[model samples]
Target chain A: MPVHPGEIPKPNTAWIWKTFWIITAITALEFAIAFVMPSSTLRNSIFIILTIFKAFFIVAEFMHLKHETKGLIWTILIPMGLLIWLLVALITEGNAIHEAIF
Target chain B: MSTISPTTQAISDSALDKPRTGTWDGGNEPFNASYGKLMMWFFLLSDAFTFAAFLTTYGLIRHRYQPYTGTPEAFEFSTAYWPIPEKVFNAFPGLHGFDLPLAFVALMTMILIFSSVTMVLAVEAGQRFDKKDVQKWLLWTILFGVIFVSCQAWEWSHFITGTDEGTLMNDGTRFFGANLAVNQYGPVLFADLFFFITGFHGTHVFSGICLLIYCFIATTNGTFEKRGHYEMVEKIGLYWHFVDLVWVFVFTFFYLV
Candidate 1:
């Protein structure tokens, strides 16, 4: 694609280290919140949100998905979207079962 | 066979020599990526679904119980409430008395992330056709990976060894450590997910290490040089990064949250 076959375009290496530091910082922040925050729905939700934020950086930056073609990006992400449905449905079912029993 | 005209014969011959434009997905490489690269993405995508299913089931089973809110001192393994993960995972290796919980797991997360960084650096070196650099970074990546797996082994062993105090079951017997049938933890299901999810991820990390060793050997053998590219490194890097990505989630769901 870079005027010859098998040619990989050289991207900035700085980006890699940058992403690493960002991830490390985010992880440190997660640790800080975990130690201080009381166990509550809001705290758990924040953890999940931060986890997603970390995931975005990994998928989009480290995996190079953001720089890829739109079609390619969609191909990878669209199928993953269905996982939300499975999670939601199963969680509801699990909660129901718990109520039924106790 | 001799019935074809000369002009028609020329057209057919050229067609055989060169594929017509726009024939394969509007002419350009599909998604502007190679067949192997595209396939890797799809494979990772499927693999993501598999991990998602496992973790989603964990979430489902976890939500079945009311959350544990007991103080650290009051905590004990029982089916009446879920055990706070930190309390269960508190003991650090070597030091017996330290009630450190998420500290070691956090270290594992950092190690895995650092290895991923090394792997991406290898990919960058590969793109630059710097085989020596590629090999160097790859060795680092593999080293970190092995270290990560070793740390996990320790973590799993510590988990299996459990606490010296152990837990007294409702029955007269005492429960120590965990296995398929018995878990000293709150619910048997928690230990099941712990072993299954973390074990599966560990297996992936091991596989990625093996793949890196292969790449290292190939780089030494001038394999990528002969092929005029180093896309293989990129492919394996994708896999290594995915392993790290999965760990990110596992750390949150299993340990932190």
Candidate 2:
């Protein structure tokens, strides 16, 4: 097939609008949860989980990572996944330090 | 070799004669991604770790100073050595004495997120080779980015000027707005970390806006159209979204949690 110069490819507008709404909805939910829910471990966990959900959508859909090849996807996701372990270890160490101090 | 069939010998011969174009030949995309996109991903990955370290340190120090009570509500309302985030961040611009906790930050968050949406739309326009649409969306994204930065500046100024003069401490001394040495808000470290973390993220936002402006000019000048692709817009879209992604985590760690 011959290609024409300066021709733009067709875009998926529906998908874009859908993703926009999804992100907006999650943000609204986050704000609502923050206002009404009492600050607790559970509330904190909810916030973290919601944040991850929003991050996933923004990365996958908006950043177009969802359409990338498996190898490329793993290249980015695997290293970021390890950061969770870092979070756990550091926070635990922080707790130990807190206990040791006044 | 003596045991090999004629077809097997032909197959082995062809394999041996095949061109040895190693992975570095630049012909093959091992991960099915272009060099620019792949490099951007790697940069973002490392950058993500930097932010993770900052937030984790924030958690470590904050937990040490946080006052705990049996009741969950008490934690939010606690007057412990650690400052309550809700209390410290509870002021809106032009709404004096309103006591609207997290309202301004929430507005800022929404603005950033909305900008992300516009960025994606711009990328979509780029995909269709719609130069005008791309310019329009990019302009909107840049406008929102500038608004977010201005709001941040206002918030910082309000913070530095010391609300209500100063909060009295136990030693009969009054501390004013945040500085490296002292702050009226909880521990001095709290103010330091807040400035460092948010300031770093805000800088990214500023840079992202600058990049968008360059892309905007390039688009108007027919750079992408001449090249027959809009990969530049797509690449920058990845960065714009990454900025938004980091803000989501920052909002969680600094504002909501």
Candidate 3:
């Protein structure tokens, strides 16, 4: 069935365009940090900050979870949460293997 | 239960039926998704986990070797220590004079990111039933994807056989200096990690290229036009964006960190 104007909600294209521009700017900042920053501490902080920003835009906008139902948001979020756990667990395992190899 | 019972109900039923024959109604079920869109989301979800695992593993390994490999490039630290990412990834095609540092990989990253943008634009155009825009943007996307894959293959070959003459480690060990193995550039374990992390990512790029081909064919055949929608564009957009997202992580963990 075709979606009626009343049935399906429309997303704000202006907001999407704004978010896209912001991400592009953030990417430029990230490149600067990677190449020009003299202080490693400052560069590391900037890199992590920009990375989180990019991830936020990806999950909220590109994935369309921002406008989705709570159930759908939870569906994607729960797996993402699990991935955090998996990263910690598996990477620790990889480290142990590295130790054994060394 | 009120006085206006069966007769009132009959009136409301007919009233609701009035719009049923319109173009917007006509037996169409709300929220019915195309297979491609659904599958794309599922694939991206799984791919996200795979990439997260790789980066996390890199983190763990780096941390475990902290004090030894940390401050790898510090001026006080011996030149014999610091791992130079630029030196490792430098690959120029049939050129002399100028030595490029990660230029090829950086270009590949840009291509994938731009293709992702084009893909989203294609989806937008698809929604508006703009077949010409969809075709144009998708062609650009396919071209970028193919170029990215080719560059990756060149990089892989460079890493495997390597360029210039170098000695093999007596024990078949591989390192980063005069010896075919083990000199500067952190623990030898990093080479293994490099191969695994990038090989897995290359596989994703390869599959994405295949999906783009399928999308290109479907668009050429007027499939989306006949369906009166652009669900396929949305599906491919998900896959394309996921590829870009993974690269963001790879760039940080592999290069910056």
User: Each prediction's TM-score against the native?
Assistant: 0.91, 0.88, 0.73
- Sequence-dependent TM-score of model 1: 0.91
For model 2, state the Cα shift of residue A20 in Å: 1.8
What does TM-score give for chain A of every model?
A: 0.85, 0.88, 0.69
lDDT value, residue B245 of candidate 3:
81
Give the better candidate number (1 or 3) by lDDT.
1
lDDT of 1 by residue, B1-257 (tens): 12347888788788564545675644568888988989999899989998999999998898898777777678778867778988987766687889887888888899999998988888888877777789899999999999999999998998887777778888968888988778788788888899999999999999999999999999999878777778999999999999999999999988988
Top candidate when judged by lDDT against the true structure: 1
Docking class of 1: medium
Clashes of each: 0, 1, 5
Q: Distance from true position, residue A18, model 3, in Å?
A: 4.8
**Pairs with steric clashes in candidate 2:** A8-B128
DockQ of 2: 0.52
Give the per-residue lDDT of model 3 (tens digit) for B1-257: 12336877688678664436555756443234444555666677887877787788777766456334343254221223335565566677776435576666666767777777777767776776666777888888888888888888877666665545333444665433422344333456566778788878888888877887888788889876666566867876787788878887787668665
* lDDT for each candidate structure: 0.87, 0.84, 0.67
List clashing residue pairs in candidate 3: A1-B28, A1-B29, B174-B181, B175-B181, B175-B182
- Which candidate, 2 or 3, has the higher TM-score? 2
Best candidate (score: TM-score): 1
